[model samples]
Target: MSGINWNECSVDFGEASYPYYFGEDCLDRIVASMAGYGADRFLVVTDDNVLQLHGEKLLPALARVAPVDVFSRPAGDGAKSLHNLGACLEQAIAAGASRQSVVVAFGGGVPGNLAGVVASLLFRGVRLVHIPTTTVAAMDSVISLKQAINSTHGKNHIGTYRTPEAVYFDAGLLSTLPSKQLRSGLCEATKNCLAIRPQSIAQMRDRLAAGDLASPQTLLWLLEESLEAKCSVMAQDTYEQRAGLILEYGHTVGHAVEMCDQRLRGSDGLSHGEAVMLGMLAAARISNAMGALDDAAVAVHEELARALGVGTEMPGGLLIEDVMDVVRVDNKRGYLTVSGEEAAMVLLGRLGVPLGSHDLPLTAVPLGIVKEAVATLVPDNQ
Candidate 1:
């Protein structure tokens, strides 16, 4: 893959040119995409934090194309709810946004997911553009059309697969992103690196350790790699049918843990990337118990996660029983139908080599082993 310049590559993930523009000037590319769609009026959805930071820079660029109406919400996990969705919809209507108007999501996963959900539900449907600012958004939430609002039951309980008309990712935005947010995005990129292209994980690990966060060269390369893997998987499983479960390698248990914690607090809490890291650890252990993955491979997976800045350690002193209970209610299965014979958990036999899904015999792995793994993952315990 070396010496072959990615800038010249036809990096189509089975779609016609979903481009990832890098550098400071790349933000304008998002405006150009809206113009291409004949958008005359733009409704921008973001949060207070991003508005204070980059909105000034992005708004003027967008206003040049259409009169831009900005809507802001309190940032963080608390904003991804049915109530906020309603508020945003109210604001959108009050602002005179019509079906012909375009909605631009100008923040991280929360804003992107929130605005995306609004676009899908507004006026039956409206054109939407995603301008993902955070790295985690760049690696996952920013590119997909999946929009969701968390429910008392679980995360993403209410949502749809309404793909945006276009996604504009300016890697230069990474410069403004905080280190933790950058790390969050890297968890997804790390997941892609391991699941789709294990060949480059070592090199990526080195770069991360060296704190090469601002390298335009590295950002450009990593974005292309992650997009290639994720888009290919999405193409084969656009509706998240069976084949798409591959993308949920760590998400099965990840979503459950996230919900369990959020339900206990009655608020949107736990960073998705952090939750997924723990979920990946849990899945790896489950796979190990089922004989799907060996100790060596699991160790390597955990090692890469640590280097990438994901808290692979489970949060709190949660018992295995409580976590498993949440797993039963997870919508990822689409149905509560796990047989006594055991269900297959997706795992990686080796980096870049998807082991596919297989029935994991949980009984095979003693509760003590899982507890030990959990304890070992807790930062305090470590």
Candidate 2:
């Protein structure tokens, strides 16, 4: 927090407001925040893992306010797809969840985004309270109103922007996460920090190099700063019409990596955060080639990866063409200046800044660069 600059890059998206309760016992704060709204019954939508880990705090607190029913699915990002969405809705119905009941997404991004969409769709929109479990969800995905169910076409191919009534982040829960998961979550934070507050990137690298991820206070401070940075930007473009596109800096390549890795197949594979780390590296290279990002910025990212124990390896065995296909098909590209232009051919520039509409030479980015990046990022030293 000390190294983060709040003045120059602060972005206020607009009038949209949602309660974001941070710190410990935030679950209790969630109930208190929603008490005034008067929900008679509550339906908590979560993953099996999170329900086992954190549901106790939320369910009991929610029960204090009203009758609470817990509905959970198997863990993993794949559970957020259409198949699970249907099952979740049916489960909610069986549990007597009604239009009047509040639906709380009680896990990370998958649960939060999925539950928010279900709430929006169920009975033409039920009230939603988002309780983000991971560091990334607390900051980036939880604030965005977009909810989605993936398809064969791509990730989040079917989704909408249905903002939750509130978002509660309890940094206390971050302690239980595995080191890999912690690094994964930190990828989003790193992406945001690199774009807006470059110094934050430096601070995080220093902290991680000093072995701070194991410290709850350090994680919380970093999470808070990251969330504030994103929230400020989200307030400007909740609908992602204009300024919001900056949020997609690393995501374009990130999603492609996830898609190529078949993230839907298994949790043992690359996580959303893991894929993003690879994506960020590739995007950094793109930025470098585009002349927007310099060696210094790229070095900062590389240093952070090593410090945080995040894998900087490029995903090997992945066909660049296949990954590019997913990139073009990504929803964000539709909002870009060259939607009609092939995204496979587009070179994504620096983290914060946009590269103007110029026909990028896709082949110009030698496969060797990606291969070298992959060599650096592979789980095992190449």
Please, what is the whole-model Cα lDDT of each candidate in the order they appear?
0.68, 0.67
Model 2 score (lDDT): 0.67
Q: Estimate the TM-score for candidate 2.
A: 0.83
Off by over 4 Å in 1: 1-22, 259-270, 317-325, 335-337, 340-344, 353-382
TM-score per candidate, chains pooled: 0.84, 0.83
RMSD of 1: 4.3
Cα RMSD to the true fold for all candidates: 4.3, 5.0
> What's the lDDT for residue 221 in model 2?
66
Positional deviation of residue 328's Cα in model 1 after best superposition, in angstroms:
2.7
User: Which candidate should be chosen as best, given lDDT against the real structure?
Assistant: 1
